[model samples]
Target: MARTPTASAGRRSRTKTVLMGGVYVALLGLVSLIIAVAVATAYLPSYGELTKRSDLGQMIRVRAANGAVLVSLGPSFGEWLPYAEIPAEMRAAMIAVEDKRFRSHLGVDPIGIARSVKVRVDSGRWRQGGSTITQQLARNIFLTNSRTFGRKVKEIILALAIERKFSKNQILELYLNRVYFGGGAYGIDAASRRFFGHSADHLSLGEAAIIAGLVKAPSNYAPTADAEASRQRSGVVLNSMVENGFISAAAAAAVDPAEIRIQQTTRENSVRYFTDWALPQLDTLIDETSDPIDVWTTLNPGMQAAADRAIDAHTPRGVQGALVAIDRDGAVRALVGGKDYVDSIYNRATQAERQPGSAFKLFVYLTALESGMKPTDTIVDSPVTIDGWTPRNATRTHLGPVTLREAFSRSINTVSAKIGAQLGFSTIADMARRFGITSQLSTFPSMVLGTSEVRLIDMTRAFASVANRGVAVTPYGIRKVITADGRLLYQHEQNEERVLVAPWVAAEMVDLLQSAVMGGTGSAAQIGRPVAGKTGTTSSNKDGWFIGFSSGLTTGVWMGRDDARAVGNLQGGTAPARAFSAFMRVAVANRPVEQFETQVPIPDWQLTPEEQMFGDVAIDGNVLESMVDEDGMPLDQPGQPPVDQPFLQPGRPGDPSQQELDQAFPPQQAPPRANQYPQRPPPQQDPRSQPPANPSDPGAQLP
Candidate 1:
C-alpha cells in the first residue's frame, strides 16, 4: 500500500481534474436551463393575449330603469375598471393575501413558492396558491388551472413574459377582473355589487377584505351562500393585510362584515322575462357590432317587485301567471312572463296567445262608441242568435233593456255582440287593429266576446290604448343602449303616435271603463284611486285576465295553465283583479293622483224595474264572492267568467293558434329543477334568495 511521492502527486492531479470537470458540467447544465427558459418565455402568449378583455364580445348587460343590473346575457364580465378606478384597498387586500412579493417580483416569486411548498408539506394540503399576481393572470388568461409539472413550467414562462410586456398595475387589473368571485360573478366590480351591493370603486376596507378572501375558494366563501364563512375568511384576509403592513391593526379591528350594507332584493327572477322580451329588440335598436352593450330598460324594479308580490300572493299553486305594467307612453314598467322562469321560460305575457274572453269586448264597445253610440243610449241585453250560433249571458237570464253604461259595467255579452254585429264585425276588427291588437281575428258573430285567442300583450296594449286616451300604445321595454363606459349607442325615439280615436271618444271609453270599476266586476281592482279596467275569464276557467289603469299606469294580469286545462274556480275578477289592485297600490304609491286625460261626464241613466233590483251592484268583491249560484253550478258573470261553452269552437279557419297546437303536441322539455318554481313563494320574498344569517348578499348569479 506504500506509494511513491510521484504516484501521490499524480493521484492529486487526477482528483483536481475530476473536480474541475464536474464544476464545468454543472455550469453547462445551468446555462442550458437558462436558455430553455428564455426560449419558452419568448414563445409565451403576446402582450395583447394577456391583456385581452373578456368584455370585448357583444355582451349584453340588461339593467333596470334605475341602472340596477337585472340580468346579463353572454359573458357577464362586470363593467371594465381602469387601473386608476381600481380601489387602492381592493388592490392592497388582494396583493397582501395572494402574493406579498408581487410589487418586487419580476413575475415568479421564489419566496412565495417555497413558502407554499413548506405550508403544503406541513399541513398536508394546499393552503396557498404560491403564484404571484402576474402568474395568476397568466394562468387565468393563457393556461388552465392544472397542477401538472408541465403546466407549472408553462405558467412560469407565461408569467415572466407577462411581466416583461406589461406593468404591474396592468397585471393587477387583468387578474382582479378575471378572477372568479363565485355565484357566477367575475371581476371585482361584479363581485362587489353581487356581495356588497356597490361597485368596487366604493368598496370599504371590510368589503374589500371579504372579496379578496373569496379568491382561495369562491364557492366556499361567497357571502350569498354562507355569511359566517365569508366573514371568517375576511378576517383572515384582514390579518394577512395587517401582517403585510398593508393596513393597521386598529383599522382592521374596526371592521364588521355583518354591518356591510347589502341591497335587499325581491323575486327578481321574474324580471328575466322582461329581459328576454327586450333582448330581441336590441338588434333593431343599435348596431350589433358595438362594444359590450348596457341595455337600459323601462323596467321599474319597484313595480316588478310589486308584480312579483301580487302574483305570488294571488296565484295558487299548480297555476302559472303573468303580469305586464306600462306607463301611459307604453313604457313597460314591469313584466312577468310566467310564474317561474326556470320551470318554463315560455313567456305567457308576451308569447302566450289564449282566448281573452270578455277582455276582447274592449274592441266591440270601442267600435260601437266610434260609430256614435253614446253611453246613455238604450240597449237590450236579451239573448240573440246569429248564423246558427246562440250566445248566452253569464247569468243565463238577461236584464231586459239597460243603459249602454249599465250593460258595459255589467260586462253584458249580448249587448256587445248586438252592437258589434250592428256596427259590422269588420268595423270591430278594424278598431282592434287600430288599437295595437296584432293577433288574428275570427270576425264571427261571437268574436266580439273575445272568442278568438289573443296575446296578453296585445290585449294589455288595447286596454292601454283606452287608458292612453285613444293613442296607440306600443309596449316597449328597452329604453336605451350604451357602451360600458357610458357612451350612448342608442336612445329610444318613439314613433309618431297615430290618433286611434277622437279625444271625446277616448273620454267616452274612459267613462265606460270607470263605470265598470265603480259598479261592475272590476270592483276588486280598486287601489285607493280611480281605476278603469275590465276582467276576462275564458270558458271552462281556462284563462283569467285583468287589464286596468290607475294613476297613469296600465297593468294587465293573466293566469292560466300552459296546457290550457281548466283552472278550478279561478276567475279574472277574483285572482287577476286582486293582483292588479295589489300591484297598482305599490306602482302608484309615489305618483300624484292623476285623473283621466279627458273625462266626459256620464249621464245618469234610469234603470228598468228589473235592472233596478241589481242596481248599485258595484260592491267590493261583488263578482268574486259570488262566482257560483246555490246549486254550485258555474255562474256566468261578465268579468268573473261563466262556465258555459262558447257558441262555436273559438278556433275557426285562420284563427289557428300556435300556442294551442304546442299545447296539443307538447314539446320535450327538461324536467324542472327540484326548487324551480317552488310552491307559492311567500309574498315579498325572493324564491332563490338564500341569504345567510347576516343576509349581506342575496343570491343573484352576478356574472
Candidate 2:
C-alpha cells in the first residue's frame, strides 16, 4: 500500500511540472510579440522623419556659360506653400483625381488596397499600385527607385506614421510639396509655375485639374511632350470632380477648354547641341556644388540664331547638317548640329567624322607655297596615273598648260594630283597635322584630295588658324564660370601656338582663298566684304562643305544626309555656301568691314613659259573692237567679213604673224606632215634642265 501511494504522488508531481513549463512558454511568447510590435512602432516615426528631411525634393538647375538657364536636372520646385495657401478648387481637383477618400482615410484606403490585392492575385503579378497621396510622398522622399514588397511595406509604414503624427490637412500639405510632375517640376506649386507660369495660389479650376491629372503619369500627361494626352487627362479629372460632388456637372460643362492655357517652361533644354559641346569647357571653370554657377562664353546669340536659320533653310528634309562658327581669336560663337536637336542628341559638330573633300586642297597649296613654290608656277593638266590610280579633273577635258593659281582657283583634280606628286605627300600631310587636322590621313595619294575624314569643329579650327596668321588657337566655348555668390571658379585664357606655315605664308594663302570667294568655286559665299573660303564636295556628292573666314570670324558648314546617302543634287558650292553666306550676313552686319592683305607681287623669274607665252600673246585690236568668226584670220578690220572669200589663202610657212597662229593651234596632221608646216623649231633645252621637282607629288605617301 505504501509503494502504490508513492507512485501516484510521483505521477501527480510530474504532471504539475509539465503544466507549469507550458504556462511559462506561453508567457515568454507573448512578451516577444509585444517587443516586436514596439520596435516596429518605434521605427515607423523615424522613417517618416527621414522622409521629411531628405533632399530628393530639391531642384537642380543647369546654366549656360552666359548665366542662362539651360535645363533643370531635377524637379522644378517652387516655394513651399501651406494647405491654406492652396485654393479650394485645386484641393478639390487633387482629391477627385488622385484619391477621393483622402480626408477620411488613415493614410491607406482599405477599398483601394483590397482592389489592388485582388488584381495581383488574379493576374499572378503586381501590375497595379494602390498608393495614397501620403504613401507616394513617402516613397518619393525616402525610398529608392524600386518596386518590391519590402520597399512597399516601408512606404506604408512611413505613411501610417505620418498620418498618426499630423492632421489630415498637414499630411495633405506635405504630400502636395513632395509629389513629382513631369518636366523637372516637383510639388503643386512648381507644377503650377511649370505648366501655367503662375503660382499655385493663382491656379484656375481647369489648370488645377490638369495638375491633378499629371499625378497619375507626369511624363505621359506633360503639356510639352503630349498636349493631347494632357488635355485627355484633364477631361478625366473634370469628370471625376463632377462624380465626386466636388463640382456640378453643369459647371464642369460650362468650362471652356480653349481658355485653359499651358505655358511651356522656356528653360533651354531644347538647345542640347550647344550645351553638349560647351559642358566640358564649363566643367573646367566650375566646381561641383549645389549652388548655382553662372558661366560666360563668347557665344553670340544672334550668330547662333543665324546658324540655326541657315541650316534649316539649306538642309534637305531628313538630311543632317552641322555648322560651327568661331571668332577671329578662335572662340566658338555658335554651333548647330542638326535641324532639330530634340529629335537626336548626337552633336555632329563634335562627334561626326565626314570627308572634307577639296577644302583640304588649301592645306596642300599652303604647304607648297611655304616650300618656295609660287602661285604662278605652271603644272601640266594632262592625264596623271599614280600607282595604278588615275585622278581626272571634274571636267575630263584639260587645259594643256595651267598656272598653279588657275589650277587652285578652278579646283582641277589632275593638277592637284600633279602638285601632290611634286611636293612630297608626307610634307602636306605633316602641315595638315600641325594645323589641327587630327583625322587619320590615308597612306594613299587620295589624301591629297581630302580622302581623310574630319569633324566640323576641327575643320573650323584649322581654317581659323589660317585667318589668325598661322597661330593655332584652341577653340573654347566657355570663357569663365562663377559661383552664385560672384566668386570666380575658373577662366580660360587665349591658348595659341604657331604651327605649320609661317605668318607670311598663311597671309598669302588667305589672299588666294579670297580670290576663291571673289570668282572661283566659293563665289556663292561672297559676303560683300573681304571673305576667303574653300568649297568641298565629297565623292558622289555625299557631303557638301563650305569653310570660310571673314576678317573677324571663321565658319564651317557641312550638309549631307544622315543615312550617308547623297542629297538632292546639292554640291558644296550651292547649299553650304548659301547657308554660310546667310549666317555671315547676319553675324557680321554690325562689325566693321575688313580686307584681306593682297598677296605679294610675283617675281619675274618664277613665271612659267606658259604664263610668259600668254603674257605676250594679244588679240588684234580690230578683233577686240568687233565680234569675229571662228577663223583666226582677222575680219576686214570691222565689216569686212561680209565678202567671205579665202582670206589671204591662210598664209604659208615662214610668215612672222602666221608662225604665232601655228604655235597657238598645233597641226593635227601626222608627224611627217608637221615637218612640212610653218612650225617654229623646237626650243633648245637649257643646260639647267634639272629643275626641282613639283612640291606636290601624288605618288609619295603621306606622313
Candidate 3:
C-alpha cells in the first residue's frame, strides 16, 4: 500500500513539472515575438526611406573641352543608359547572365541561394553569387564591400527593407545603376559607350551579350585590355542566354562567334604627345578648380592626324619620336609623342629633354644679328680649338674663308663655335633663355652646339618667337571650361612677351633660313612652296631634329631611339625633315602663301680693290663670295689647274691685299700626286682651257 502511494506521488510531481515548463516556454515565445516586432518596426522605416530615396537614375555629364557634351555621365552610379532607352536584347542579356530569377524574386530567393551555395561547394570556390536583384541593390546603396559578419547582417537587413519599400522594377533599376564596370566606368550605359562607342539602346544582341559578360570580372573582360578573355566570357554569356530560355537554342547556334565586332572607343583627346605637353599648362589653368577640368584644346584635328602619320612613317617601331605643330599665334595644333598613344602615355614632345644639336644654332645666329653682327661678315672657317675642344665641320675639310651666311647655311660646327666664343657663351645662353628654353644650359663651350637638353615644346615656342616676329607667345591648349549651366569657369588668353630681338631681326633671320631649304642642309624639307628651317643631327647620331616655320605656322620634329642609343645612320634631314615636310604639306595646304619679309634691303656698299679681286664684298648683311659656286661647292682643286677653269692668280690684283684675301679664301686641295687620278693622255693645254668639248655635259658646268 505504501509503495503504490509513492508511485502516484512521483507521477503527480512529473505532470506538474511538465505543465510548469510549458507555461515558461509559452511566456518566452511571447517575449521573443515582442522583441522581433520592436526591432523590425524600429529599423524597417529607415531602410524603406533609403530604398525610396535611391538616386540611381541621375545623369552624369561629360563635356568636351569646348563645352560640347561628348557623353553624359549616365545614372545608376555609372549606369549610363538613356532613360527608357535600353534595348530589349540588352535587358534580356543582363537578366540572363546576372540573375535569371530577377523578375520572380521578391527581395530574396531561398531556392536561388540554396543552388548558389551548392555550386560554390561543388566548385571548391566561391565563384557563384546567391544575391537576388534586391540584395544587389541593397548592397550597392547601403552596404560596404566588407566580407565581415556584421556587414553581411546589415546587407540582409537592407535587402529586407528594400523588398518592403520598392517594387521589383525599382530594385532592378538601382541594381543596374550601382553595378561596377571596369575602365573607370560605373554603369552599363557608360560601359556600352566606353567599350563600343555607342549607347545601350543601339547595342546588338552580340554586343549586349559581351557587355553583360563583363559583370563577372570587368577588368579581366575589358575588351580594350584583354580581347581574348572578353570574347571567351561573351561565349559564357551566350551559353547562359540559351540555357535560361532568354534566346532560342537555334538563335544561339546561328550566332557567328567572329561576327562580334568589338569596337573600342577612340579617345579623341588622348593624343599622348600633345596631352603630355598640355597637362602642366592645364594644371596651371585649372589649378583652382576642385575637380579635374576638361580641356578643349585648340588642336587642329587635321594637323594632329598629319603629325601622327608623319611620326609613324618616319620613326622605327619601338623607337620614340616627338612632334609639335602650332599656329603662328602659338596655339598648339597637333602633337605626337610616340607611334601609338595607347602603347605609352609619356609625351616625348613636351616632356623629353634632348640635345637640340645644330638646330639650336638659329638662336646663336639670331643673337649675333641682334648684337649688330651682320649676316655678311667674313669669318675664317679654318680648324679652331677652344680649350682643347676642337669643333669640326660635318665635312672633315675646311673652306678656309666663308661668309657668315654660307657658314650657317652649311651648319659649320667650327664657325658656329667661333661665333659663340666671340660673342661670349653667356650672351648666347641668355638669348636661349629668353626664347623659353627653360632647361639648364651647360656652361661648357659645347653648349653652343646645343649640347644642353631642351623639351620639344620649349624649343617649338622659341622658334615660334621667330615666326611671331620676335614676340614670344606662350603656347596654350584649353580655350575655356564652363559649368553645365554656362557659367564661365575658366578661360585662357593669348599670353605674349616681347623679349630682345626686334621684328626686323627675326624677319632677316627668316630670309637667311630660306636659303637652307633652297640649297643647304635642309634641302630635304623643301615642299613646293617657300619654307624656312634648320636640320639638326647630334653626335654619334643619337637625336635627329628639324624645327622650322612657314609664314603661318611653326613646327618642330624629333626622331630618335627611346633607349638613347645611336639611330644607325639616321640624320635630321631624313626622318625629322620628312615628317616636317609631310605635316607642312597638309598644314599649309589651304592657307594663302605669304613670303618672308626681307626687312634689310640689299646694300650697295663699295668693295675695296683687294676685295674686288678676291671677289669678296659686304652685301645684304653677309660678306659676298665669288670663289664658291651657286650650289655652295668650291671652285678650285689644289695642285692642279682649277678643274674646269683657271684658278685666279694670287698677286695679279688691283691691291696688294688681294693676294692675302686669295690665300685666306683658297679652295680645297685634291689628293696627293701619288694618289692622283689615273694618268691619261693629257688634254691639249689650251690658253683659255676652252670649256670641255661636251658643252652639254653636266660636269663641264662645274665652276
Best by TM-score: 1
Predicted candidate 3 versus true structure: per-residue lDDT over 31-138, tens digit per residue = 764564456446654533543323444333433333333333333222334336677777778888878888877566788778877997899866656777677666
Tell me, what's the RMSD of every candidate?
18.7, 15.8, 16.5
Report the lDDT of model 3 for residue 302: 66
Q: List the residue pairs that clash in candidate 3.
A: 60-73, 61-73, 65-296, 76-177, 78-187, 79-187, 375-622, 376-621, 376-622, 376-623
Judging by TM-score, tell me the better candidate of 1 and 2: 1
Worst 10 residues of 3 by lDDT: 686-695
Compared with the true structure, the alpha-carbon lDDT of candidate 2 equals 0.73
Better of 1 and 2 by lDDT: 1
User: Which regions of candidate 1 deviate over 4 angstroms?
Assistant: 1-59, 74-88, 103-106, 110-129, 167-170, 183-186, 197-202, 597-703
What's the CA RMSD of model 3 in angstroms?
Answer: 16.5
Quantify all predictions' global Cα lDDT against the true fold. 0.78, 0.73, 0.69
Candidate order by TM-score, highest to lowest? Answer: 1, 3, 2
Top lDDT: which candidate number? Answer: 1
lDDT of 1 by residue, 1-703 (tens): 8899999999999999999999999999767656766776677666566444653345677888998878766654566687899989999999999988888988999888899899999999888778888888777777788778888887877787677767888889888887878766778987887776777887899899999999889989988778889998999999999999988999999998778765544354788788888888877877656456788899998889888889989997899989999888889999998878888889999888899988888877777775557777888888887777788887788999998888988988889878865667766776776676777888678888888888888888888877876767888988888887779988888867655665557778888888888889889999888889998988989999899998888899999888999999888888999999999999999999977754443211322332322223221112233644788554664432235644223268755476765655454454544233213224264221221111122321111
